[model samples]
Target: MLKLENITKRYELKKKTVYAVNNVNMTFHKGEFVSILGLSGSGKTTLVSQLGGLDQPSEGRIIVNGVDTSSFKQQDWNNYRKNNIGFVFQDFHLIAHLTAKENIEIALSLSGLTPKEKSDRAEELLALMGITEQRDQLPKQLSGGQKQRVAIARALSNKPDIILADEPTGALDPDTSVQIMEILQALAENGHLVIMVTHNKYLARDYSTRIVALESGKIISNEEVRPSKQYKDDQLSTDKSSLQFFTAVKIAMNNLKIRKKSTIFSMVSLIPSMVLIFGIMNLIFNMSGYKADFKPLLGDVLGKDNLLYVTPFEDEQLESTQKTIYKEVNRLNVYNPRIEPFKNTIIEPYTDDAISDMEDIEGVDKVLRNTYFDVIIDEKPFLLMALPPKAYASYQYGVPKKHYPEDHEEGIIMSSEAAKVLLQDNHASVKHLVGTDITFNIYNYKSAAIKLPSIMEEKNVIHTKVIDIMDISTKTKLMSNYHAGYIYVSYGYAESLRERFDLDDFTLFSYSVPDPFKSVVGVEVEGGFLITGPQLVADPLRHLRIKTSLQEKYNLFQFREFDLNMRGNNYSVKHTVILNDAFNKDSLAKLKEYGHVTKSRFDAYSVESAKKTNEYINYSLLSATLIAVVVILIPTLLVCVILYVSIILRTKEIGILKSIGARNKDILNIFTMESGILALSSGIISLVVALPLIQYVRNILESEYDLQASLGSNPMDYNMLGIITAFILSVGIITMIGLLPGRKASKLQPNTLLKHE
Candidate 1:
């Protein structure tokens, strides 16, 4: 039972006054069939709407079963609407997209019913309303009378204690109106409190047990039209469904069937967020550049393909090593990685002022000079050196700086290895080399004397040129003899007659690869045995030890330039003797067993440059493509917001549903489900559209030059499919945005819906 006392409602908009409801008192008893009659603007709707808790009065007291409803908070009222009330509207506010059965399902779905329970219950309800055959039809497919029947069925879905009807016959013809009255009358006879709001006095008089007439926002009469008798309702036997929040959501989803146009519009709006996703992908891809391709960035970069390597050798085996080198070079199809000697023996000793007129070399791109051994000066070790201003390679191993220090022309760079060696001598390498003219003339041989510096930091004897400093990783495998370390200027400068005239040619290389173990497979047949086992087991250190032990018993240094040629099973190598005294045929025959030792660490170092650039470029290109793909999120986000707004406007229908007893979660699901459908469609379209675009991109980006880049997006990639699955997740996320407003609409109480008279 509900009772209202001194109810007052007002609207104040820009100082204008509105008496939507004013000082009204009314009492509604259980099992009482009543009609609220009034003219237009008589506050008929406002009064009933307040009773249902859709709105609170400006000043009033409302009692439900002896308790004032005004004391209930919004959440408490929400529970009240969910549990106790049922509503029907004359507009037949069935969700247009949902089938008749689905419309009823939205109301009953909150009861935690099973799918089977919902299906069976919905079907039963439809049968009770004589619309079972039309249960699958949408509202638009049904006649007005059929639609109204569906609305009434939906209202009773939750099996509430009372029924509220607002203008139950407003849009019906007289004959149909009478048929609707018969339904209301029948319900009243079954002991239901049928409270209806309508303007038709004749219809009220014909069916209602009591007529409560209202005029000018006040009750004019409360009279009994017919006395009620005790009645039993077999159709009212509703099973208590244990519906939960998720169930309510499912119901809301079913209701969203009405807004097809809105759904399509929402999907269309999400394009920008998709674009953003693609943009992020682009950024990641562009930043790294190409890495896996065979193309080189620059000549020195090897910038794309080719491999270079380096290793130091014992002074004794130079001739034997040279023979193996020719054999390996002839065997491999890649760039020739020639062995270079320490620049120290080549560039050192130019200390005395013995100079010849110099001329720049032609066809040579750049020259790198570095071959300084650790040596002592005044009981302290400072690196004595020459540094190159430029070098030739496809890719740069060292990261480049945008700007260089001004004093680099007068300064030299040092490595941690060099620094530690110098610190032991009680003098800092940088300070000792700065401000003071020092001697750079020291040979690797301990027997050589220290000569004064002929080349100054600011001036060169040949020609003056800007100087730049650089540091690099170094190894002393071959430079075992005592010598100072230096890393600048050209080999030509270091090799002038005034410098030490002893060093030969060789190449040295080192690299920090992503995974050396994983990449070992690419190394094919070498002058050494072709390694065909797991990479982790290959130990270069152990092999070096074996070679070292063999060197002590044999004359390795005597054959620095001897030719060693091997193909398949047979190989020939050369050995030059230091003196005829040790050059007996027997001594040479003793070294024949180690002929396979031609493959040396020097080979690996010589090819380091070419290999590093190839790997780097291929890796860079793949990274760019991935980054470009991920950037699509930007466009996806843009589209999501626009769709969200469209969803809010489409939810006006939620009001109609709430007045008909749908729960908050029920409405949430409707909007979420609707948006999910739209999102799914959009995602599918995007993937279909993006596939060809990505293929086109793959073709365009095939090479740094006009050479074709490969399309690497694998058609059978499960991981890619997994990424596409994320679109489903994104749909749910976007659905949440639309659900918020739908939930609010569903919570609107039928009793608060002040129906316009």
Candidate 2:
């Protein structure tokens, strides 16, 4: 069945040529127990290696079943070895992790047999070798004789036409050696061409049907002492086959199980890399630029871009409005947010036609009128906004819609800053102040009627309970840029307060009326006003005060002096023109025609400043991310080193797999799968450890520091997108790192690999 013609194996040693197997002729038929007898360096093993397709002959041709192998490619040789030839080594190079049955099954795993067929075939071979009971034992647990028997059984499991044994009895005791020889003799008798290379001539004479003696690299004598049966069966054809990915996975898992400590160490080394990546992702995701310096002046009631604040433009207050600059810094925000207050009280009222014209603007959604008044709660000043029901419904912020003021509910909703001041605890949660009573002292500028200053004193008191606190879940320009604290009261309540204190009728300053002087008895002076009214006598800072009576108790008169240029009524009723989502440029320009318009935070300078601040923050975060990458690389490099060393240590196992018909792809798959598992394990463990830490930090910030104080939005909020992205990145990086060593392992040659120590 096999023929070798003029085959000469040459080698170069110390720059000199040596012929290990000289050109010689050889032929062997099927079912012949051939024993190759040779001393050390006799090339008997080299000759057998060439016949088994483990290595090619350096000279001449090897023909099998009349088919010359001179042009056989690597794949062809692999197929030849897989389907027609089986190897039994002296040392029994079975994989250490696999049991005896598993060792046999690995060979058939490449044959495209179903899992049950492979198992049954392995069981039959074990029974034939008289080692059925030891099928479940690993090579390390089996005795020397049993290991050799398992090796023979694995070789015969594929039912190859030729069995090549290289010193099959070399490592066993005498009795075990004889038993192994008897098994080989039985294989040759059962239609397998058994070829064994041995140094023991006595065993060769007793069991081998043909004894071939080799001296140097040449075969000297070939004799047949016993009759051998001629082959009657057809030669086995080469079948295209490969190791399945799941089979490789099974083998890889077995390898990891056997090297438990190494696998554990590999997984441990990758955990820190995973944790660092996840931590950096969280930090990057939480950092924001808009919350630092620039704030949005308008809330989300109407889109910020569509909400227009229209300040009445009069010639007298032109310079004041020009000088009014919106401060970007939080501490400098204490100035009047309205830009210019009511002066000697000329309320340029919006006439019916003017209101209709504003409503007629192209994209106008609605025209909202609101009033601002000065108030003091617990001796702290606040700007109270009297809002209509529509405004209350629009500014829900974080509170539910149902929590806002109902039709006639007179309670006030305060901002977090106002709540803290009222409760006298900056760190306390505003939610606790809900449903608690609060007293506000309403004040107006009486003496400084024209120019509002610190001289304005308390006039009336309004007692109410806090209904809700603004939930600043998201930071806006209004929260960051508005100087005064905010408190919201229903429109009806504010009107009642105005009437109770005569805020709109003959008061010195009327924000809603064009001229209060027409109703009250007053005369314009050089720099002030002289007004006659019974209410004026209560003025504590009246420059000049007098009382007069025209009749009995009913007709009474009082006089109080006031400065004409004093910052006029510190309060002003204003209207906001809210537009639809599709508002155009013409709409804004038309609105600006009536008064000075408030610029949004997205204006040029504000956007530029925010960009610069965010760039700096981005750079700082990038530097931290680079450091984290370096830290992560340290462990990734360790993983690569460990896998490389693992490949080196398992070279022998790699050879055994190749000899058992495993392709390079199979070896690659095994290592690749191992790396994937390691990366997945590290990612899962790191996330488990990091989630609790993030939650703990969030709780501390929310409780002790009140996250809303510094950050408008909570940065510690959990982001599953960041976590999942980090995990995928970790696995991809580690898997790529592992492929380096896997490729090295796949390129190894089985011929030289088997002989490696």
Candidate 3:
């Protein structure tokens, strides 16, 4: 039962009020076929909308089963429309994308029936409407009368208490109109209230047990032609159902199918972003050399961290205001122990006592002392490093397989580049250079600091046999100018030259240190100690005894000068101390009592510096990736805007769905799912298309850049996780963009939407 008490609906045009329905009072009972007949603009439709709860009257209360619905919320109104009333529009507003049976099933989806039950119910209703043969046919494929029958069946799907038909047969032929009216009359006979609004008097007169006439905004007449047959009311079913997730997905897929061109276009729009993201990730992985099997060439040169380099220095002072002041040095100066003139000329080389003291350090595995000097070979200056024959055996870069140099032998090893420079005319192969005699001229720095070029005094001339020519590319880090020329000779020959020149015995003692990256120990020199590991730039020595003892033993009170053949004007008394792999910070501090200590070329001390450099590189890469994402957003933003406009254009369809028992959340799910589907489809297709393109690009790079070994050599090189992450992120963002329009469409009233349609 439904009742209207003084219901009024008003509209304002140009500041003048016009009433669509005014002061209407009526009541209708179950099992009644009631017809409201009026000319156009007679408020019949507005009154029906008020009864159906699709629109609220401006002034009055609609009473259903003795409950006033005037103050009902929007959700309550929706529930009322869903469970209590069914609507039939003039144009048969069935979803264009669904078949006749599917359209009915959509309404049945709110019946709380299982999927199979809903299917069975839809078939039964379709058969009852005499359109069972057209169940699988779309709305456009059906005849106009068939479409109207399907619309009526869908209206009956929920088993509502009231059927509100707005011109149910307005577009049908006379015979079809008769058939439609008979259906309504049968529903009334079956204990359901059927109300129809029509402009045709003949149809109304034939179908009605009661007739109500309206003129302008007021009801002019109400009359009963015959007493309606009284029947026991068939109670409307109260079961409720919600939109399931899979059902939502199916509905979304159907919508996408109906709009094929738009969906394809959306998918195609995402390809470029996907390809660029994948390609960049691949490049980063390759450049970082992340393969498990790859090892750096530096590892071969460093030889497992068992060597250390030690350089000694002399302290300096200046008199200021009649007081002695010790001068500080720059910490960042990688080259330390500045060599100066005469104040401290002679370097007290590490004696047997000093060597014993160094070997006594905590982690001293073995100590090998060597002397290095600058010599002239064939009028070209080259660095000459002299070490014992045993030390030569430990050389990482090059050691002769045959004819190895002995301790007392006069054999020398020269870099291939240095030999080429020295023997310009007769520079043959390494085998030819072997057994060839080469002379080295050593300057007498112990003579005097001459003011002018009076006569450069030559201290000693030594002739030696060339035993080997080595390639020094792997030892580049050991040289100040990595590509500079150099030579290697035995310690006995160097000692003989030193004796003849009357020069200071500048011995270099080396040992090893442990955990090279974390060690902070160094021997105390003039101003500061030479750091053993590359981890630190320059840190002051912590032990005072080591500093004081080193200063006293090395006679390092003032800086000294030495004449280096190739090295222009810089001077210092340099000594080296080697450490085994067992040295710790304490061992390094103990060594500081002798002289400034540094790690040798073969140590792993530079690992820390390399790690820091990698960290900066990673940060730069992250910044680049962020910039790339922002660039990708340009197109993503465009897609979002387009999707919003597309949703806004479908407001009428949204209203139709709501009228058919779809809740706001259901409406929201439909649109958001559509966007997600678009994003996912695009992402998947783009990834599929990118794999071959990436391979092709890799091939091109390998051939063009000669990087075959570096580009695609590893099988575990794809960015699968990154690709999946991008897809999810893209779908989420697009779904969020659809929310504003989806919510707006869902909140719209059915009557307002139908009026526009």
Q: Which lDDT values do the candidates have, in the order given?
A: 0.48, 0.67, 0.63
Scored by TM-score, the top model is 2
State in Å the error of residue 561, model 3.
31
TM-score for each of the candidates: 0.51, 0.61, 0.58
What stretches of model 2 exceed 4 Å from their correct place? 232-236, 285-604, 700-712
Best by lDDT: 2
Q: Evaluate model 2: give its TM-score.
A: 0.61
- Ranking the candidates on TM-score from highest down gives 2, 3, 1
Sliding window of 10 residues with minimal summed lDDT for model 3: 535-544
Question: How would you encode candidate 2's per-residue C-alpha lDDT over 1-757 as one tens digit per residue?
Answer: 7888999889899999998899979888888999999889999988888888878878999988888999988778778887888999989998898899999998998898999999899999999888999988989999999999888888887788899999999999999999999988888888889999999999999999999989899989999979998886555467865887677888777777777898888777777667777766665555533323222222221236656655564323543543442131122322233423432233334554777888888998766544445555776556566665645466323444655666456878887766765667767887878899988765433321222211232445577888878754433321232322567776666656554543232223322223322232343443333333222222221211122121122221111111111221122223566778767888889987876555421222323333454455567568767876786688678878877888888998888878877777778888887777777777789889878887787788768755444444345667566667777877878877878898899888888889999
Error of 1 at 99 (Å): 2.3
Q: After superposition, how far is residue 71 of candidate 2 from its true place, in Å?
A: 3.4
Query: Each candidate: how many clashes?
Result: 139, 9, 19
Local lDDT at 216 for model 3: 86
Q: How close to the true structure is residue 423 of candidate 1, measured as C-alpha lDDT?
A: 48
- Looking at model 2, the pairs that clash are 295-477, 296-477, 296-478, 450-566, 450-567, 450-568, 451-566, 451-567, 452-567
